[model samples]
Target: MKKSSFILMSMLLVFTMFVAGCGKSENNNASGETPKTETETPKESEAPKKDVSLRVFSTFGGTDTAREAFQAALDEFTSKNPNIKVENDTMSANDDGFRTKVNTDMTSGNEPDLLFYFVGADAKGFVDAGKVVPLNDILDSDSTWKSGFSPAALENVRQKDGNIYAVPLTGFYEGLFVNKKIFEDNKLELPTDWDKMKTAVQTLSKKGIIPLAAPFDQSHYVIEHFILSAAGSKGHNSGLADGIDPNWEKGYAAMKELYDLGAFPKDAATIDLGMASNYYGEGKAAMILEGSWAMGNWKDPAVLDNTTVIPFPAMPGGVGTGKDVIGGFGSGFYLSKSTFDNADKKDAAIALLKHMTSPAVIEKIALANGGTPAAAGVEIKGKTQTATEGFAMVANADSVNNPIDTMVAPETFSTLRAGVQAVVTGKKTPADVLKEAKDIEDANKK
Candidate 1:
């Protein structure tokens, strides 16, 4: 079927399902004629008809793959409710493009009913502008919903004023993706401490294999490797969950040593995440530090299929040893107060939210994308290389440190990312980077 016709049919089916469930209402007098009643009847009004339509804004880029998944989700939601109709407005990948679209919509009083948000400054701005709804009431009224999410996961999306504006969909953990075959082929044991890890990298490098694969084009990934190197050395509880600051000196020192040893590629600074994956998939590198989201793509049957994930190796006398690493909730969903205030629209949107977040939906998304589900005990069909790797890292971690971007204030995020990138790229000394970060934080506070 044509795409437009498909969407229309899906929406129509949804409207039918919802309308079928609600009782119809009519106005009549006690005499059973269509006339104004002498005594107005006092009773609860009937639920509104299920013909309401809501628009959802998203940054999924609307690729055919994403569109198919979204349509499936909407179709399922409508099938269950049969009252609400949801249409999606997908945005482009260009960061400015999305911000422009949202801003335009907000100003024109044509804002969507819901939006997908990335936690931190982006979501904070919307909350500050009163463009997003405070979900505190909904959360408080629904016990099962409130209890379903992990506190750490939920905290990332909560507003500073103790009100929740978004519901997290899932979390992506970052870790080292190791080539198990390489380790076994070299008769090398997996490293559990700092000394062993260094020895392994050096040994593997001597054999003409790059020990670590890092995509340098994405500065954040490069910086995260540095952060993990420190976290692994310092241990997970050293209060260095704060990234790239002066307090994280020990971590920086460790990262610098790895750079000096040439653990990453000769031009690691230029390689993006995809290039890093190619390095590992083609057997040019032994491991890469990446987010769990990468798992889905890495596990594509077309790519190498023998890789496995593990925590960053340990460092002697470090905070939490190699077993402790960093991770947190990756993305979120939010509701608009304007949408919820309309009685017919409100019930329809709420029902959609609940259905899309149900255990079944969570499992499908996880299985399809190879990421972990936010909802507990939801069983998915399969695992991707990245997801399995993420699970391994999570399992090994004595504790998972929050990704700095998820925990720190918005203005500080850019400062933190830049500082870490500077150190990783050898453009700035660790001390210099740390000092700069401190100044930025201090200034933001003022």
Candidate 2:
């Protein structure tokens, strides 16, 4: 009996030992200290994504519709990309010091991850400095995005080296914004030729109405339109790189003729662009020379209802036939090479740029500003008469040239503006202005 009792005790001890060992193994697996099978799931906290932040800069501020549209698109981007944060730094494009600020930041190596600025000669400095990233590879890799841009828009941003540094948003064209109703009310003909323009100016001036809202203080717009009208695209572009071409003399003379005929407001010599726009918007003036982008400022219903755009009338004996336009891809976005070099931020920055310049966003901007869209297949819905006329003028233009202010060096542009003002005010003749411009250009070359 004693032997049997001992055997039972031994068996029970063994069984208890086996069960305890099994429990230890199960605990080890649950504690995650042991290797698991391939079927095991990953924890939610494992391999978390790192958050990224980007700096974006632009010249879209104030109550401008472009600003609002850009903000909306940026908000949407942030919502979609919760892992990425964008810091927007904006300023007024109309600010005289805008270019100075941009250049300072860029030169100081404090550039934003993305930038909105003028293309062509204005962007050439950054591109040459290797500060801007060439977008050819990115655009080529993404066929959808590449196909959305118009060829002409792409060409405008393409550099002489065949590299594209920016993505165009909205292109612009310079023309005369006319009050059709005002002309009809006065029994005046639309200014289709130099003679008709003179007739219209005389009739309007005699009735105490300002025929054209001319602002000499900020006369770049006037100079651009007059030069393109007189010199044509080929003549203007050829002369802009060098000093003032002889063709520019014709442009200066044309502006002087208009000034002598009393086509401008009495205070035109002192007023700025804003004042000139107000003069036209308030129905005090029959016409204003402005770009397509200015359409947003004319929000007065009366002004909107009466306004239509037309090319400037042909200058007498000018090289241009009055069909040449002064405009192209005036502004676009530039990507920073430093931002794109970071392994983590590169993909996100590219994605953000693509999203910002997407077809939907571009269309929204165009509609809000009533400007020409750079993206292809973006139909301007609920078109204004002004926009319709502007588009028609662009489509029918014989050739499009960049504004002189955009093509020339900053000093030369300033000199040209002041010279044109002098000519318009009769303080200097066209020949005198051209000689002074040539001197400045020669000095700049040296």
Largest lDDT belongs to which candidate? Answer: 2
For model 2, give the 10-residue run with minimal summed lDDT: 238-247
Query: Every model's Cα RMSD, please?
Result: 15.8, 4.0
- Candidate 1 residue lDDT tens string, 366-433: 66555557776664433554455567667667766655544444445556555555676688877776
Ten-residue stretch with the least lDDT total in model 1: 22-31
- Candidate 2 Cα errors over 4 Å, as ranges: 1-48, 442-446
Instruction: List ranges where model 1 is wrong by over 4 Å.
Output: 1-53, 59-70, 78-112, 120-122, 143-160, 203-208, 228-247, 299-305, 341-345, 380-389, 409-411
**Per-residue lDDT value at 414 in model 1:** 58
Candidate 2, residues 212-253, lDDT tens digits: the string is: 997776788888878777887877776556556777888888
Q: Each prediction's Cα lDDT score?
A: 0.64, 0.83
TM-scores of the models, in the order given:
0.73, 0.88
